[model samples]
Target: MIRLAGLAVAPWLLWPLLGAFIGLMPAPAGADDTASSPATLLPAPVAPVPPLLDRQQVDAAIGRLDGIVDAAMAKTAIPGVAVAVVYKDEILYAKGFGLREVGQPEPVDMDTVFLLASVSKPITSTILARLVGDKLFDWDDPVRGHDPSFALSDPYVTENATFADLLSHRSGLNTGAGDLLEDLGFDRETILSRLDQQPLDPFRSTYHYSNYGYTAGAVAAAKAAGEPFEDIAERVLFEPLGMSRSSYRHTDYLGHANRARIHVRVGDPAERRWEARYDRMPDAQAPAGGASGSISDLARYLRLQLRDGSFEGEPIVDAGALATTHLPHIAGRLPADPTERAGFYGLGWNVGYDDLGRVTLGHSGAFVLGTSTAILLLPGEELGIAAITNGEPIGVPEAIGSTFMDIAQHGEQTVDWLSFIGGFFAHEFAVDPAGPDYAEPPASAEPPRADDAYAGTYDNSYYGPLVVETEGGALSMKLGPADAPKRFPLTPYDGDVFTFEPIGENAAPLSAAQFRTGDDGGIASVTLEFYDRTGLGTFTRN
Candidate 1:
């Protein structure tokens, strides 16, 4: 049977499969507007429902939870981990393991807050669902109706795209459209405003996971509710569910005393070790990844999900509105083998069906700098598990959740989940070796022109101004808003081609900056390879 892994935020490696899973094929050509409705998007079960594991069987799996987590921690060496399992309305299991940070004595506990990363998407969807229940907005409502600032390059899409379209990654903004801007220190408003500069795919028919696209949908909901997105989330979901430790603001997470420090892997690959760092500040994409909460808080949230948006017997959101978040809305991955089942993405979750024909709702969040989190819900069994770690993603969280689900469903893990899922994460995040080695110039590399000849101020409508200037003895480029431009020192590669290491979450080790001369033999423009994903990286000399 086909199984699924978690959703990753990395644009180049968004969807990674673990097993076979079916996704609804996009509507045929000239289909009606209703073709992408939730009713029409849900995939048929692959097989008849087998007899589910009995309560005793599930409890037995829970009994082995400590051992499973312990084993996973030992294998991954994740600095900190907190896991919660919910069955029916009860938190069947909740625990923490390892130190909160390397060389620190503070042990991770149930209350230790960690960044949720992309897992925040699912939480954001929950907030929208509650808003939908209040009649503040509908999933199908055009985002522009609420927030006129939300727009895309395609006029038709900007005017017609619905909240559902954005949440399901079908608005056609290319994968990670605004992420580069976010990495370049752009604010949320600036990123959203510049989305019109991004190229589009085929509107609703294409699935391209975009963090800013998802954030745009949340922003529209906040506008409709007449409040900030964070406030709406608190009022509609967090506060109602009693998740006091949960918050979408990065500042709140910083103020918490028991929060886990985010850590990244460093040093040699074979001998890599975790180091605490505060480099990833996700406030710009708050709705997409800026969330921090304890496992105890997530357990409460999970209970509401399994209970159809009810908290402690009280209905927090309409069941129908909440259910829509779990239904397949678009095909996430098209398998190379036609016979293989494809994967689907729901409103904010990765939707798949397990071997038992039970619907599985899952999402994996990662900040390449640090933090990895995963959540898996079996709505059919009313069972779910959430795992969070304060370390760079190496599949610790996905492995933990997948292992728990496997044990619960089949009485034992069917595979070495850590190795299987971790291998995929490793491959996805692995550095590509095919690119030009900028560090080693060609033997006959031609010398660049005089520093003054290539130094000048260039401009691009989308990225603003980029200043190439001669530093002490070398060339450097500064780009961003006028007040706070990021600077990168350029190294001569070959002829007019110079290279610099781009920084931030989406940066590559090295990127080539090629300068082209006009008819007058004066440098006319420079194209930054790293920022050219959507054809917006070229800066023409002013």
Candidate 2:
């Protein structure tokens, strides 16, 4: 639960940005490309978005979020979208807009189903929580003890880490050393064997996002409960929460005829929209993120969490467990002003914070062209928000998320749509011609040499193994098990500063990377902050 203040574009991050590139920023990318907007396949917007809550104040709040949503879409490259808000047991807001399938021209509505991606974690966590309550397994169970099939390159973490450790991301498993990405064609057993090569960091310190880890834990839960992951989910979550329209298994949606299409954020309006899929998980990883449902159905589930883990007079997770689950874990900090940090991870949700630092437990997901989200407040208020889209939008999930809280917690109105987005890209990500980044100093622009200084295996649980190389007078971004390492021609921008230009087609262009020199005056860990992704990480010499 990295705080939203750090990640969401705000007034402060927008000012200088607009001043820098409002007039000269690159023309929106071609559709289907993240760097640009869509080129074709534009779908018609849905009929007027239907309202869920009628409160003027609530509408004002929803409007603020909607504005951000519109802008966020422009940045993220999303197509159609559906959103729902719930308070207590009452539906507050529900709306639909954009196309459902880019190739096809259908609109989206409440019943449209999209891949849940990581948003599936909380629901999976809720089910496992019920299993824990049922004495099926203990949170303390060593993950491997419950399912010996679980293995990683790091033997110590493999044997010592428990279910709790896995949930907390302290298992130290670097990204996907097990070759899950490459083995998209393999079955469960085939992929799990690659674990021996993936190293884990020392366990129990910080939160590391790992799809493989969560999927593995989910598989273990399924094994422990003696049921298929989907079955267990149906019995424990979907049914009780009345997410009847939801399914763990994939399906082509026929309901809620008006659904948003998936679009590549190629920066244009004309582009093809299509469905995308997730090929990883469940050698047994159902527990991390593997479920989908309508926005309304997810809202019901959120209402349950908002009501202290109960909904419609039924307790999904007891209040005591709810408290424990919602409590913060992992010093989980997103980059932002320390004073404004506003969220943390609690069990499975990415909880948000406000000016008061209160908890707003929520979660969001992004897989291919689609993004899913569920955000709710559980303290003094019981506001909940959920959205599902077939195609990914530029940061729409977060935009919608923050606006929900601002309205729910503070009664703020939605900002002006076009203006906000106009301001947003202008501020947060724009590269300034005269800014400090361009003015910084680096040790030398002379091509970095391969002085053993660039040799080491850097491991990040979320990013996996990266082999740094000094090849042909340049650095290499050898993302092991992720297709191939793309080479970069490093150009120093400032002090130990550099930018990475990917080689070959579809290679990222002109992204920033910064380095730290070791005591001996050679580069140590080079921490990179790239555009359009989660936290940037280190690539140690391997």
Candidate 3:
């Protein structure tokens, strides 16, 4: 893990197996080709040819999965899990394990809802393909074609940016650019408006994992479809796929049942305890990571993709367009490894292969305090597995997906997957929440000035404005728009620098807060940093 601004940056933390799958990247060759040159694409996807298993074999596999899951839960103290596996055209198995909420007897079920996190990217990609099939806009069309105001700090790339560029994460923006605004309660349109102010990377020269880029793509798609993003998804994707329980809006989950509660294990191993989190993500970035659904609902989605964009024999999007979605749009950098080639970033999915040279595609989604989701699609074996857990991730979903693929592809005897994969992600199990490596504010510091001294609003060009107020003799900060936006408690650490106490486990772990002083010795600006990346912005006193 790379440390950025005193925080451990694990951009690849969620994509632990991506490097191993680099060998399975597929080539494309088909009609309805949307690429600038289809001939340059990889060969067509290989159809799944794994041997079919008898009910006895299937039952045993399910039993093994149950044992692995149960062991993982007990060892990690994970609260609950929902898993669904599809082989060929059949729902091979779907089951829930453990409790939806720790200490509660209710078991997680097929319909239990978990946040899809970045897993929403692939769904967003499919939605883009559906719109392209409808002739809403060409995949390569300039992003500004749909939203004339769309832009980056660099005018050249901004003028040349395309929908595919945004979706493929080649838009030259830093990873998670414009995310601070989302975390601060800014709405989608506002986030889009402030995007130009965020920092950029080398133009199309690196694989910067970005959620804001997808959010921008969604904004453009919304413009092209002449409808809200959620509405477009509902009409074009969910309604047709029969994803009755899936929704991008938080309001839709208000009274929903069997919803997974976000749980965090705090304290040391001896005294660690699971705690529920109440923090929520901003709805504006729904296109990026704001999706919630069950394993059953996601199984239908996987089935659609497995059938090459057809749903129940009806064409949702043309096969060629779907194929184009899976093709790598840009080179993705991975550490130099003798075993795997440099990876590539596709539209939403990471395009690559397994060691056996079989095509593999997948994505992982992580909710900071709650759940982790993994979806692996092995087109070569007509197999797909989606695993979601209600507790903090301990490689449950990835291990399950990998084990399912191994069973279908290799037909091997059951392996101790819990111990095998858990060993790879041991740091996850050994997370010391109270360790100094965390971004918590130091307890030995006091403010250099009175609390009211720093009370005021600060502004940024691209991230919008932030308000710092003194409430109850303590300093608090709020960002963007909200009825009563959540506040971060500020504790002074060094001269003119402070740290914020996180509100909840899911809330952004803001590390250091520095107040730039004017020549007059007054606070002139403020800057904040998070574990995910660098300092957000220099918010000047308004």
Candidate 4:
């Protein structure tokens, strides 16, 4: 009975949100790792991404939010959103918006579950902190102390990497370095084995956001606790905190009936049209971003943070240990226009100051299957906000959080954030309606060779084998390790270039597949440009 309304609008945020903060940029055509003829490429103008928020509009949005959300949802056509606000040790608001599914009449309610994505990190950190309170392992203890097999390319880092370093994303690896393996169905152990082969960024010299680093920390925590990561999280975090409705496993989330379906806009920005897909992040990545829960459940989490590691007069974790998670372990800058005046990367939380110079802590997460989430905690103000949407790249979560903060700090004012967001995004989409048009090849060009010529097995060190085959004069691909094989149906665009649409229950956006010819006119290699604008290159013919 607590359904509200919200608009899922924002053209700039349309990029895939699976990785760390570094992979948010939009992709361009002819930007793949392989060499191709310029004449065969299709280039289009890239739209300028709007800044995070407009102060005036944010103030306005908070006032007329209901009507604004209704109008914005009407325009964007997004299916559903859920929001929760915790102020001064109490939940000030908790509600859902729109339907759980497009054709289903069951409206989303406060209990509707949605994937937390990377927002699961703070919880993970909190659990680890509890384990530390039990003297399982110290934060600065070397990772190898828990798991001797833990190794990295840099010998010093491999020997000295601590639990704190991994949680804070300062383990010296590049952003999302091993994500390719995990996405392709590789297990955590398998991906971790190949991690030493990746290049290191510099020993604590830079903050390179990494999902793998957090997973590594989780593995270490599990090793020290003598149990699985999910089990430890449940015992130390969920159960202790009384979050009965939350779970770290996707399988568990699926068993719940009130979960919100994931969705994304397919064609143009002007259209609010969306396509729903089930969450496909493997259980192996759960430690990094696989938890699911409802607004009511998240409110409990915010409450726990506000109380400094206590829930219902019981100490779930030592306040001192919990405070360590908020301490700035590494300083860094955010992607905002002004470069995030004062920002630091804490364990699983982004610690920074708002425009009002008040301390704020938060993190965000998303997946290719269509989910975006953000959680913010203002310990100084005893306020927190958690926003989850079944759609992506809309900036809805941040908008909601900032709107709530605006209300908390400056007192309530006349604002319609949703309508203002919708109108601004609608106009921006109208100005540059085409999305990723620059990433496609020319459609009129003929195939460089027969379909049979390109049919064969291609392989890479990290991504494994990709089998391209022709069936009934059409091309299709099956890739990844043997455990999880994904198939893609291909359509020829320009010469030797084909676009593949993910085929299966959990579908992804169309990706470009370009086959390169050798000097002898035989297919030499193929390069695939994925949704995140990163390319998997030189899948040499086998």
Candidate 5:
């Protein structure tokens, strides 16, 4: 994997398959995510295709969603997009937007590759279903017993927790910087040792979303299915559905020129400073979220799911398995996680329902670098809609499905359920949190000097070797060699406290920093706090 900060390229290439996809590395068709590499960051824009009459009407229902996504894309400076839409068994929409690269001037087509991120989970689940169909393994089988290499710090948990427990996020694990570990190509044996670091109470009442849980599940699936997870996904889903372009291969496998340029927006507008493109992640984390493919492939995959895992008039996964996969294993209000609170879990999917209890099975995926998807199925309505966008959609799946279902089932408007849940949280946290937390939080007690004090090297457990620097009288954080945190002015609160309004708000949702003292009453490290369930960590100067 290549690492270039600020999304800019060095003299090195971005690898081969990506370059092939970008087609050209020239301006307007530049490859890479942030903007740097052997290729230019400012690729030429392809011809714009205005939304047509049909598109306009479709946008009307999904407009709030469309607005949220387009704003995020513009804010991020990502150049192109391709999406597939499926309603029940019908392919309602298959379209591409913008271009794969800026300079190549070729619009993104049906086969442009992208990093799938957590979307890989459903594919993993599909593979396990096939194994269940064969009686090769049961979902309730304790995962550790299947793969003896799977051990936790707590042997009891490892010895007892079943695949269903881990698959559904009941394993109570954390990210554990799992992607970074896997990116370095850590073997299964080495990585399993970290399992003890994340503990779970047998009947923990609260829900915790764990990506690491899925990684372990992926590993277990490979062992129990008697094949690699990639082979099972292709054989059971991709090949059967004719999703030819889909691959578990990393986006980095593509040559530099063939990859779509990724953009990081300075502000929430395209007119602002747009950073160049780069993809700095390791290829080994593909199981968590690294597959790439075109819209057609996604549509075909959706078609297979809509037909109850049947393709070409034959059942690839038995109907019984499919039902259990969609069954609600656990039910509660959306978990109390601070940042990623879209909905709750049903096996590998998110289960969202209303008071009268109509169920929609779905899921969403996103990563800081790029790529995302939102898909929901209404069994009673016999309708399924899958919407995959490149970045944050702020709950666009409900908007898309609501609009489509209105027109599909004879023009009836239904409440946007996503809006309700999202808004409920907005009112709770963004609008009326328990109390006025940061409405004029204390100003920094220090004078407005250059980024002198904070501009130095620091370290953390999650991401190491963090370097902060001063530029234009504001402070910016360099996270490893990847993207630098946006610079912002820092101010003083009361006493010796300080406030970093712009950048600090984004840092972690804490108000300000306060110093604590040792037994001698001397200065010690300051703590950065956040809301419930989110982590609160401290950094001491070295």
Candidate 6:
């Protein structure tokens, strides 16, 4: 799992995109070449090689889905889940389980919309693939050619990075760069404009999963199409595929009548109580993590992917162009142990090879505020499954998809996948107990300076101006855009160090604001620990 600004991105979610199947070695020379030999000697008719899983095996797997989903929900206590499985050209199963909300009477059905989270990455790639087929722009074309405003800290990278480079997360931006700005109420344009301020890793040689970096590529693609990404998605892919219920706009999701309300676990960690919260708004990075749709709508998408960019006997996107989106463009995860397999990332999907050397494409999506979604495709078998859950990620969707794939290929699950995956999620989301207990201050702690001394305007190029003001004898800090700054009331932890509870999706529970003094014994700078991921959280006192 990747942790940025205290937000945990599921490890599986970090994997993305697809690639071509590993081909068989060619037959020895002089085997059967009718063209080189006499016309009378014809080669024997060859039988078609069977698929990895037969119809009977697929049917048997579909039969066990109900039990798999039922047991997962019962154990996790998630509010709702919608799952759809597509095999060949048919929808093998599409169903929804549990309530739309824990306390609501409306039950989740096949049409119930849920946020797709990072699963939107593949959908974005699909739309771009359509544009590529139309000759709008090639995947390797430099992004600046399409959008003049696009840039990174490194001028060379800014001018040379391609759509494929950014989409595969190899442009070298720090992991989750620009995400904190989004959490701080910064809009898309503001966030995009500020990405040049972020530090890079090692140009195209580094793989750091960045949402805004991916969004930058999508935004550039939209510019090349001369339309917003949402409109392009509908015009190029959604409408053509008859996915009327799918949308990249957060407003459309909110307007949906049967949408699953996002639910997060509240109360003690052991208690596991859930509460519905309408807080996450991912429109800023829509191309990377903002998509909402139903299982029925996603089933069609799986069919298109399995059929190589074709849907319902019609080619919506060019097969060659779409295949580019699945080819491994960069190594995403290197195995820590010899037994584990290395993972690769393509345009917007995770590419991996199974034991049989068959290509497996998958990506997991999650919002800690409450949604979890996953899609896994076995292209060799023409089988794929998509699952969306309306609850905080506890590995429910991934587990469901894993269980289904196991049953499809092996005829039975090899292990308790839910427990195995859920344990990782639990550990990732667990609060770190190493930090200081802000609620209890040490009796020997030194007192803070006068409120007026700390009350001043501070400036940071990356995060903008931060204003510390004295309010009713207490100090408070405001940071973000001037119009809508987020205010955090400061509570003194020690001399010159105050603690405040950070807010928003990427916020840490408690962050310290340490005031630095100059030779004059006056505040010179303030350092915010939570906003310092790239070492740019310090603000000079103005």
Candidate 3 deviant stretches above 4 angstroms: 1-34, 37-63, 413-447, 450-453, 467-469, 475-478, 502-510, 529-536
lDDT (C-alpha, whole model) for all candidates = 0.81, 0.53, 0.70, 0.69, 0.49, 0.82
Q: What is the clash tally of candidate 3?
A: 11
Question: Once model 2 is optimally superposed onto the true structure by TM-score, how far is the C-alpha of residue 355 displaced, in angstroms?
Answer: 2.5
Model 3, 1-542: lDDT tens digits are 33323433222222334422221134333435546632224445555335444555555566667766776677777888888877675787788888878787887898888777778888988998898888888777888878897888789878888887887787878766776666666677777776776668876666677777778888888899999888988998899988988888977755577787777778886987877755455477788788888888998998888888897889998777777777767777664544335456778787764544455677877665666778877665566778888766556777777665555434653455555555555554454577434354457654478766688988766555678988787788886575656677877676678787544323444466778889998899887655225445678897
Q: State the TM-score for model 4.
A: 0.78
Worst 10 residues of 4 by lDDT: 26-35
Better of 3 and 5 by TM-score: 3
Candidate 6, residues 1-542, lDDT tens digits: the string is 34433444323322321111110100011111222211112233233234678989989989999999999998978989999999988998999999989898999999999999989998999999898889898887889999999989999998888888888888888887999999888999999999999989997667888899999999999999999999999998889899999999999999999989999988886897778965589999999999999999999999998888899889999887787776666767676765556677777888756655566688888888898898888776788999999998888888888888877777988657787777767777777898656776778999998898899999998899999998776789999888999889999998999999877766678778999998899999999988887998999998
Write candidate 1's Cα lDDT for 423-480 as tens digits: 8878888788887567788899999998988898998989888999987888999987
Q: Which 10 consecutive positions of candidate 1 have the poorest summed lDDT? A: 19-28
Can you give the lDDT of residue 524 in candidate 5? Answer: 46
- lDDT tens readout by residue for model 5, 1-542: 11222322111111101110011111111111332311111223333223222434443434343443354345334566555556446665665666665555766666666555556666667667777778776677778877887765467667776776666666656433244334333444444555564445443233455666666777787787788866777777777777776777654336534455443334543455434344534234445555655567777766666667676578887655654555444433442353222234545665443222334555555543434455555543334555554433233333344445444432334443344433432332243356336546445434433345455555444333445566565554443223343333334455435444322111233355444454665434444442112242354544
lDDT of candidate 1 at residue 58, scale 0 to 100: 76
> Relative to the unseen true structure, what is the Cα RMSD of model 4?
11.2
Instruction: Report, for all candidates in order, the number of backbone clashes.
Output: 2, 70, 11, 7, 55, 6
**Stretches of candidate 6 above 4 Å error?**
1-50, 433-439
Candidate 2 stretches with Cα past 4 Å from truth are 1-56, 59-78, 103-105, 176-184, 251-261, 267-286, 334-343, 372-378, 413-542
Write down the worst ten-residue block by lDDT for model 5: 15-24
- Candidate of highest lDDT: 6
TM-score of each: 0.92, 0.63, 0.85, 0.78, 0.63, 0.91
Residue-level error in angstroms, candidate 2, position 239: 1.5
Off by over 4 Å in 4: 1-77, 334-340, 355-357, 413-447, 450-453, 489-524, 529-536
lDDT by residue (tens digit), candidate 2, 298-376:
7777777667667788777655444444444443444466544423454565543332333345555654334444344
